[model samples]
Target chain A: MKILVTVAEVATVDDEFEIDGTEIADQYLNADLNEWDDYAIEEAVQLQEGGVADEVVTVTIGPEESEQTIRQALAKGADRAIRVWDESLEGVDLLDVRAKTEILKAVVAEEEPDLILSGVQTGDDSWMATGVSLAESLDFQWSAVVNDLDHDLEDGTASVRRELEGGVEELSEVDLPAVLTIQTGINEPRYASLRGIRQAQRKPLDAKTLDDIGVDAGVVDGSLELTDMYEPESESDATVWEGSAEETAGELAEMLREKGVTA
Target chain B: MTDVLAIADHRRGELRPVSYELATAGRELADETGGDLHLAVISGAVDEFGEKLAREGVDVVHTVADGEEFNHDVYVQAIEQLVDTIDPQYVLVPNSVNGLDYAPAVAGRLDLSIVTDVVDLAVDGDSLIATREMYGGKVETTTELDAGTALATIREGEWPEAEGTADASIEAFDAEIDEDAVGSTVTGFEEVAGGDVDISEADLLVSIGRGIEEEENLDLIRDLVDALDATLSSSRPIVDNGWLPANRQVGQSGKVVTPDVYIAIGISGAVQHVAGMKGSDTIVAINTDPNAPIMDIADYAIHDDLFDVVPALIEEFQ
Candidate 1:
């Protein structure tokens, strides 16, 4: 079996905002790996260790710097890596969920992986829906926030455990050739080994563009447009109450009531 | 006039509050866009559920009674069929687990633009602007959709419940689910047991984080909650350390709450946790660290040890 993991690099906001008292582009621009992507990579590695998959391939879409993140996943023991590089792909909102899903669908069509795992949501775009979107695009069985997965290759079925509200757990079984979005805390990610790090540098990495996947960036353009980006106002006035415990409690309750918080 | 479809999420024969809120939001959007509101219910014996939705300003309720329980494919097919029939200007769903699944699937199949966890929605001329949190709630970004039709999965409690009567006509729609579509089968469900109190539904919540320090100190906070008859919840770290169950965690990964009174005990208010409870009517933070993020959002801040502040609050409430 083969597993595919997709990661995206996102931007962070810095203190220096924009010219109009809004945070500037620099303030709005910090880049990092998808937090949940790490979990996806870790899960893939675990599957390989358990012999559920013979190899794990990591994929990412971003500018050139994103290769560093993919390499990190390689260091974490992904067998190979693929980077879909396009400078214009930066700052694209998740409104193109279908378009991205199509691109992923095309990748799956090419790679023909048995199982695909994704982070439940991305740090940059916490939409938490892309994995399912990709699943539907590929017409594959899928589960979201999956905490556990056990595969039965013979029956082409897999048992999955998902986290639900109120600490509830739901167990379901989906057929193979499925997609799953992994939640955090589902497993402990292993640190990069010295051997894995050295091996990652030598592993095969295929660089591709949207053209390679037969997708035009224009397909996603008309859906959503970034009219402008600005920083949110910091509306924090830290009011400190100083007094005895009883006094503070009385004051707190009164304040809440006055604010119409407590009836 | 276009039609807007709102998917209702129900489990164990009960509808979630977010389902009501999403319906209200959908109705408002439909009104603004000169569209009709259509509610879709998927489950076994969804007639009663469909009727309940009809009262909420929905022009029609579409029911898909194909399964004893939820199957992803069944829901996806039902929603996909609804979208095909309605050609809605907008599709609204709650950003819950079930919604998170089928909403995107429908969007993917229809090749529609989609937004998830949207907190605000408005029409700017012919386009729709959706405001969502970015960087774990550190910033808010608004995405403008130029597409003719857009799909959004709204965060629960973002919109107030609407008041208006509807014809509430219930329509049972055959989803034409196939045996292959129901390939995924639920083996069983294990409900987590502990507090009878549903914190999400609680109007008053007193939540503690790692700031409380020790497991034993939880008793003191419990006393304050008891005195005020307020529900007790906690941050992820508290739950992760086993001081509280995962159900009590108030954060992006846990339960999103908008209580009338949300008291933060020893919680520093990480963005993930704040995103869950910042919508509370009143926020009170008690922490020794004046610089904690929770203090920034608190209506009132007490810079004191929770150990001391809680006991006093319990006594005063009693």
Candidate 2:
């Protein structure tokens, strides 16, 4: 069995992200692997180590900086890494979701993996629908927010349990060649050791452009443009609780009722 | 015919509260476009669910009797076929676990412009402008579709529930679901980690975090919960430690809550945890760290220790 895991490289903004007119203050941002994709990478490695998959491949789409992130995945146990980046892919609000999905479809077509796993959503972009959209673009059945997963290679099915709102868990069974968006707490990601990191430097890491994936630059258009991003205005003024604990407690209760927060 | 299609979501025969919310939003769009608002419900038996959706603004309730619960294959197949028949300008679904499952497929298959987690909607000429939260709940963005059909999933709790009480007419439509095409079957829903409390419905939330320090200290927070008649919830740290059940956790990973008042104690607000409770009407934070992220958004903040402050809050309520 073959499994493909996709990860995103997110940036940690220093201070609050700022805006000078319509342009953003991009200098404060430093790219790192998205927090949510840790589970996807870990799940992929676990499936391989457990013999559920014969191979595990990691894919990412970002600038050249994302290669570092792919290597980190390699260090953790991915068999190989492929990154999609082009000069045209640079800047904010570009690289349309459908176009990105198409590029991924091309990769999937080339790899012909039986299973695909991705983070439920990225820390940035939060394009929450991309994983399912990718599945749709590929004409594959999918389940989102999956927490528990088990594969029956002989039966040609996968048991997936999803984490839903209000703490509700739903179990489902999907046939082979499916897409799943993994939620957190599925597995504990192993830290890359010195030996693993050294070995990762020698692993197979490839890069591709839109042309290489057979996608036209004309298709790369922003559906949602970034107008302006800045700090929101304060909700309201709040009186600080002062003096000793006992007196403040009394004041708190009175205020709760005053605000109609307590009946 | 080019109107709005709102999907009425239900689980185990009960209408999810967000169904009414979507109906309300759907009606607004229908009016703006000068077209009728149509609602869809797919289950093995749809009469009960269909009648519930027959509201004032709802011109028609499109029902498809297919399965007991939401199935991906059924939803995608049913909704895609429904769009072709109704010729809707906008497709509205709740940005929920089940809704997100099939919404993307519908949008991808149709090649429609999709905007998700929508909190607000407006019509500008032929484009539907959608307002949604970006970068956690810190920033709000309004998205304009550049395509013909708009596929969006609304963020629950941000909009008021639909109050249109008109008795809408029901219209049954076949999704033509082929069992062979269905790759998955939903079996059952189980409780995550055996927690019974539904925090989303709480009127007030008294949430704790790492500041409480240890498992033994949970009693102090519980005391406050009982005094104020508030629900006990926590951030991911406490849940990760097993100090509280996963259901008691409040964050992006747990549940999104919108209550009248949220009193966050010893909780340093991270982006993930803030997303779940930022819709709160009033926010009060108590922590020694005045620089904590939770303090910035708090309506009222007290810079103090949890052990000293929580006990006092309990006494004041008493």
Candidate 3:
């Protein structure tokens, strides 16, 4: 069985990070593997390690630095990595849901893996629809926000339990070659050990552009655009307590008492 | 005139509260864009849901009785037909699990500009701008659709629930879905859980976050819990790390707790996490970051490390 895991590099910026022209301030922008994708990678690697699958391939649509994010996945035990990058994709506004989804669709057409894993959402877009949209466009059987997943290689099907709001969970099954959006906390992601990190340096890290992947550059049009970004209006007026830890705790306990929280 | 179409979401033949919430939010979008509000519903039987939509002040309920349950292809096909029939400038959907599952598919098939989990919506000139929280709700981004026909999923709890007036029209639309397009079969749902600990009922919750540092540090928190006689709970990090059970998780995906006292230690209040516990009578935050979002909702926020605050709090309570 071959499992395809898609990951993306997300920006880590301060709460006050402001948009400078079309993009945010450069100084506050730094990149890391999307936090939610770590769970996807970990699930894929665990499935592979448990002998439930023969291979685990990770893919991403990102810049040159994204190869590093792919390497982090490999360090956690992915067999290889594929990076989809184009100079035109460098523009912040160019790569929208359509562009990203189309890119993944193209890659999936090439891989033809039995199963696909994607993060439920991203810290950047927080859109919560890319994985679902990609699966839909590909016409693949799919499930989303899955917290528990188990596969049967012999039967060529997988059953998953999805986490829902208010502590409800939905259980369903899909045939093999399906896409599943993995929810976080299904399992703890492992750190890259010294050997794994060193081995990742030598693993196959393939980079493909739009033309190389047979995707047109016109998907940027009719895409969702970030017209502006700013902080939301403050809805609270919290009182800050300033004192030593000892005094502060006493004050908090007293306040809780006043509010009838505890006596 | 342009209109915004909202699809009512239902589970097990029952309409969800977010069904009205999305309609409420969509009513504003319709009013702002000088468009009427239309609601489309897909279910094997949506008679009850259809009547509710009418009372919610919707201009029309484009009701479709295709599948008793929500099938991916059924919803995708139905919403596609509804969009074509209405030609609404904006398609507003709820951000529930079932809603997110097929909303994207319809948006993709219709080639509409899709936005998921939007908290705010506005009309800037001819463009439709949307605001959504990101980075765990620490940052707010205002995004716009480059085209006219756009799709968005309204975040639940961000908008008010639609009030009912029982005065609206209903329309029936048929979705042409090929039987072959239904790729997967539902083999009945198995309730994998029940009888587990329900943390939402806890009177006092002593919650910890990444600032707890390690699993061993839970002992320090345990001491405080013992002093305050509070139930031990945590945000996603501790729960993800297996330091706490999944039921103990207090966040959007977890249980919503309205404890009398919620002492959040080291938890940076992400919007998702706050959604579950903002109703607590007293919320105390202990974190080094003075600007943590949790601090905003906290009645008494201590700008100190958890390691320093937990021990002192335990002693004070004792």
Candidate 4:
């Protein structure tokens, strides 16, 4: 089985940051592989190591600067990488789920992998819908928020543990030519070793344009438009305990005593 | 038609509370659009769900009796047929794990614009503006959808549940479900958090988060918990990192804890984490970043590093 994982480079804002129009100011933004995708990549890599997957390929829809993040995936274990970008995508403020699904669907058609893995949601946008939407569009079976995936694929069925709300997990089986949105805690993502980082430098990282991928630039022109961005007004009327660590601790202890909490 | 169609969510024979909230949201939008609010109660005990959902603001309850549990394929087909029949302008679904499983497929199949996890919504002329959070609750954003037909998944706790009884028209619609398209089977559900500790039963909870930094640092929190005679709990990341067990996790997917006091240390207080602990009588946040979302709901906040403050707090009790 050939496994394909969708990887995204997400931007995390600093604790104290400035919003430039509809985005966070550039200086306060830090780019890294999305938290959920990190686990997905590890799951795919482990499947390959177990011989259940013949190859593990990663696809990312990001700009050239995202190569650093893509290499992180390759350094860990993916065989190669494919990145799709275009000038048409540069102007888009918010890349809606459909636009992403369309771009990834085109890639899936080209790759023809037996199974696909995507994060349940991106850290930045958190659409939490793309993987299932992609599966539906491609006519593939899918399971969302999967925390565990069984490696035995002899019957072309993926037994997964879907992490439901309120401490419950649903055990389900999805037929192959399937997509599973990987949830965190499925596996521990390994750090890139010195040898793996060296090998990643020589690995294949191919870039494709929208034209090359057989997707129209108009896909970026979706009906969704990001019109406003602002910090939510703080609802806190918190009594800030300001002092040295000792002084603050003293205040907290007094409050606990007053409330009869430290009896 | 300018009508709004909302889907009621259910699991394991009980209707989720978000279903009623969806009704409230659907009614609000329908009123703005000058149309009726139609609620679709699918699967399980359809008649039971429909009768219970026939509350004020719900003009119609369309029930489809299909599978015993939530099957995405069943949902996609039922919703498609309903859309074809009702032609509602907007379809609202709960921004839930199950809703994540199907809402996008419905939108894709129907060729409608889709948005998820929206906290607020408003209808302005021909456009619908959805307010949502991004960058882990650091900022809020508004996205305007001008698409002809749109589907949105609403955040669970954002809207109030529908109240008062209304004489809503309840009707059954038979949907053509393709058996071949249903490729997944839900075997059973396991409660993974059932162990020695139940955080929900705790009184004073000392919850730690990503700010604890290292596993060795957990001893600091443990010491404080021991000193205060409090139960120890944590945000999802600590459990995800394997530093803690599933039972200790406090979040949407874990335990919903309402303690006498919730002392959040280094936790940024994401919406999911907040959902689980916001009901605490007193919220105290101790973190280096004063602007963390936890501080917003905190009754008392100490803007200091947990490393320095936790040891001091423990000493105070000693």
Candidate 5:
């Protein structure tokens, strides 16, 4: 079985950062492999190592600058990589789920992999809908927020544990040619070794445009438009203990005592 | 048609709290659009759920009696047909786990604009303005969908539940579900976090998060937990890192803990984490970042490094 994992290079903002219009300031922003996609890549790589998957390929919808982050996935054991970008995709404040679905669906037509894996959501947008939207667009079976998977796919079925709210898990079986949105903690993502990093440089990393993938630029006109961005007004009226660590600790200790919390 | 159709969510045999909240949101939007509010309760005791959801301001309840549980294919098909039948301008859904499973599919199938995890909503003329968080709640953004008609998933706990029964009409709408399209089957639900200790039962809980840093530092937290005679709990990251078991995880996907005192150390109080433990009597935060989301909700806080403060805090109790 060929497993295709959807990866993204998400932006991380500094704890103390300024929002320059609808975007964060360049100095305070850093790009890295999406934390959730890191797990999805790991799961796909492990399936290949366990002999359930014949090949593990990664697809990313990012700009040219994100190749370094995409190579991180290749370094972690994905066979190759595809980076989708075009001039039409630039300057769009927010790429809604449907636009992404249309773009990924075009790639799916070419790859035609047996299974697809994507992170539950991206760290930046957190739309949490692209994977399932892509599945619907392609008419593929899908399971969301999956935390566990049984690698035995001899019967062309994927058994998964869908993590629900309040500590409940739903065990389900999805037929083959399915899309599974991987949740974190399913497996530990391995760090790229020296050998893997060298190999990644030699691996195939193809950059495709919307035209190259047979997707129309009109799809870039996503329905959603980001109008405003700002730091949420803090509603905090918290009593902050000040001074040195010792003084703050003393103040907190006194409060705990007032609450009758005994040591 | 300017009507608003909202889908209700349920698991096992009971309607989740978000269903009533959806009713409230649907009614609000319906009022804004000068349209009636239509609620759809699909699958799993729909008749009972339909009646239960027929609250004040709800104009109609349409139930599709189908499978015993939530099946995305069933929901997608049912919602598609319902939209065709009612021709509503907006479809509201709960932004819960099950909501994530089907809302996007419905949006893609119908080619409607979709927004998820929205905290607030308003209808302005022909556009829908949605307020949502970005970068894990660090910044808020308002997105406008000028498409006029779209599907949006409202976050749980954002709106109050609709109360007081109404004389709203309840009807059964037949939804043609294709068995061939239903490719997934839910075997059963297993309640996790079953272990020696239940953090929900503890009075004083000391919760740690990513701020704990290295695995070796967990020992310092363990020491503090012992010193205060408080139970040990943690945010999702700590449990995700395998430093603590799922049983000790205090967050939306874990356990809803209402302890007497919740001392959050090194935790950034993500929305999911706050959902689980915000009901605690006393909330304390110890983090170096004063602007961490946890500080906003904390009753008392100490904006200091956990390494410097935790050891000193432990010394106080000892």
Candidate 6:
């Protein structure tokens, strides 16, 4: 079995004053691998370690700098990495759902991997629909927010535990050659080691472009446009209940009751 | 005139409330777009449920009673047949497990622009503008569908359930589905434990998060829930740590809840967690940290240690 891991970079806020400031669109930039993507990579690594699969490949579509994010996945144990590098890809307002569907469709058509795994959602788009969209695009079965996975390579089926509401868990089996989106808290993602980082630097990385991937930018006209960004308004004269622990508790409880919170 | 079709979801021969909510939403959209509302029911012996749905301002209820259980291929084929016959302007489905599985296939086959987990939908001139949370719950983006026929899987609990006025006529439609197309078969069905609570139907919920500390502390929240007769739920962290079952989790990765009163105890309120419960009518957050994001949107906030506040609340309720 071969699993492909896709990663995307998102922006981080530097100052509270600029929480929603437009400057974040520019200055707050860096290619940090999404936290959930680590889960996907870790699952792939576990599959490889168990000798269940031949290899695990990491893919990312971003600027040249995104190669670092791909490298980060390699350090976490991806067998190889591929970067779809194109400067024109920056600020392309495509949600991960649409962008990943286009890219994964192209990649799946070429690789035809037994299974494709992705973080349930990316930090940037966080739509949590990419896996489903990619599955639809490729006409494959898709499972969302899988917290546990047990694959049978011989039978081409995977037993998965998915979280339901009210502390219930549901187990389902999906035939392989499917897409599974790994949810957070599925496992403790392993940290990159010096040895693994060094090994990652030596691994093969194939960089391609939109043209190479056969995704014409014209087809994906930015459906969602970002008009402007601004910081949230501040609250004035917010009451602070400060005192000893017991005193503060009493005051807080009185306030909550007054607000009809404890009724 | 164009029409809007909503697929009413049912499981184990019972109608889910979200199906009614989706029907209401579909009716509203259809009215705005000058179209008729069509409700589609797919299940065995669904005539009563189909009539129940027909009362909700729906022009027609198309019932397909073929299988004893839900088959993705069967649903896809049924939806395709309806779409082909009605040529609806928009297809609205609940963002539930069944809808998520089959809606995309219907969209793919019809080559329609698809949007999932839509929290807000509006008719914008000739297009449909669907608003969804991005970056978990940190950002909201509105996307306009250029395609004439758009398909959206609305997030559960975004719209109010419209009670049916009276019974209406039900139309039985035999969906054309080839047995050869049904590749996957449900060998069996295993019901998950604690499926009885139906957290989605609970009007009042008291949810706990990792801040509750340990599994034992859950008793305190449970006591409070008992006092209020509210359902008990948790964040993904507590469930992931095995402190609670997976069904109790409330978030993007778990169940999206929209209770009338949601009391969050010791939950720091990650964006993912908030996205699931933000639709609650009233939110009360209790956390030691005054800076917890959950407190930001909370209707009421207690900035005291939950250990102290929870026990006191439990005592008062008792």
Candidate 3 lDDT, tens digit per residue, A1-263? 89899998898877456667656677877889998899999999988888898999999988887788889999999999899888777775525677778989999999988889999888776778888889888878788888888745568777788777766777776776788888888888999999999999999999998899898877655456766666656665777788998988888878867766553
lDDT of 6 by residue, B170-206 (tens): 8998887887766445444443434556677888788
Off by over 4 Å in 6: A11-31, A96-99, A161-171, A222-246, A253-263, B166-168, B187-233, B241-293, B296-299, B302-318
Q: Tell how far residue A136 is off in model 5, in angstroms.
A: 0.9
**Model 4: per-residue lDDT, tens digit, A1-263?**
89999999999998889998998888999999999999999999999999999999999999999999999999999999999999999957899989999999999999999999999999998899999999999999999999999999879999999999999999999999999999999999999998999999999999999999999898898999999999999998999999999999999999998878664
The docking quality of candidate 3, as DockQ, is: 0.63
lDDT of each residue in B1-318, candidate 1, tens digit only: 378898888876787777778778888888888878988889866987776776666788888887867677888788878888888888898888778867888787777788888888887777888988766555677888884878899987678765555777788887787786665788888765346557889888989998888889888888777788788999976765566766788876677799888889888786668868889987888888765667668888888888888877776656
Flag regions of model 5 displaced more than 4 Å.
none
| Model 3 ranges with Cα > 4 A deviation | A14-19, A259-263, B187-196
Q: For candidate 3, write residues B256-313 as lDDT tens digits.
A: 8998889899998887799899999888888898778887899878899888877887
Residue-pair clashes per candidate: 6, 2, 3, 0, 0, 10
User: Rank order by lDDT, top first?
Assistant: 4, 5, 3, 2, 1, 6
- Model 2 stretches with alpha carbons more than 4 Å out: A21-23, A92-94, A151-154, A242-263, B193-206, B209-232, B237-243, B251-263, B266-283, B287-299, B303-318
Please write out the lDDT profile of model 4 over residues B1-318, one tens digit for every residue.
Answer: 899999998999999999999999999999999999999988999999999999989999999998999999999999999999999999999999999999989999999999999999999999999999999888999999995999999999999999988999999999999888899999999999988989999989999999999999999899999999999999999999999999999999999999999999999999999999999999999989888889889999999988988888888888
Indicate the residue-level lDDT of B173 in model 2. Answer: 90
DockQ of each: 0.43, 0.47, 0.63, 0.86, 0.89, 0.27
Model 4 ranges with Cα > 4 A deviation = none
Candidate 2 chain A least-lDDT 10 residues: A15-24
Each model's lDDT comes to 0.78, 0.81, 0.81, 0.94, 0.93, 0.74
Error at B152, model 2, angstroms: 0.9
Chain A TM-score (model 2): 0.87
User: What TM-score against the true fold does each predicted structure earn?
Assistant: 0.81, 0.85, 0.95, 0.99, 0.99, 0.81
Better of 2 and 5 by lDDT: 5
As a whole number from 0 to 100, the lDDT of residue B71 in candidate 2 is 90
Candidate 2, TM-score vs. the true structure? 0.85
lDDT of 1 by residue, A83-112 (tens): 775545655544367666766777888889
Cα error of candidate 4 at position B99, Å: 0.3
As a TM-score, model 1 comes out at 0.81
Report clash pairs, candidate 6: A165-B247, A166-B247, A166-B248, A167-B245, A167-B246, A167-B247, A167-B248, A168-B246, A168-B247, A168-B248
For each model in turn, which proportion of the native inter-chain contacts is also found?
0.67, 0.57, 0.69, 0.89, 0.89, 0.15
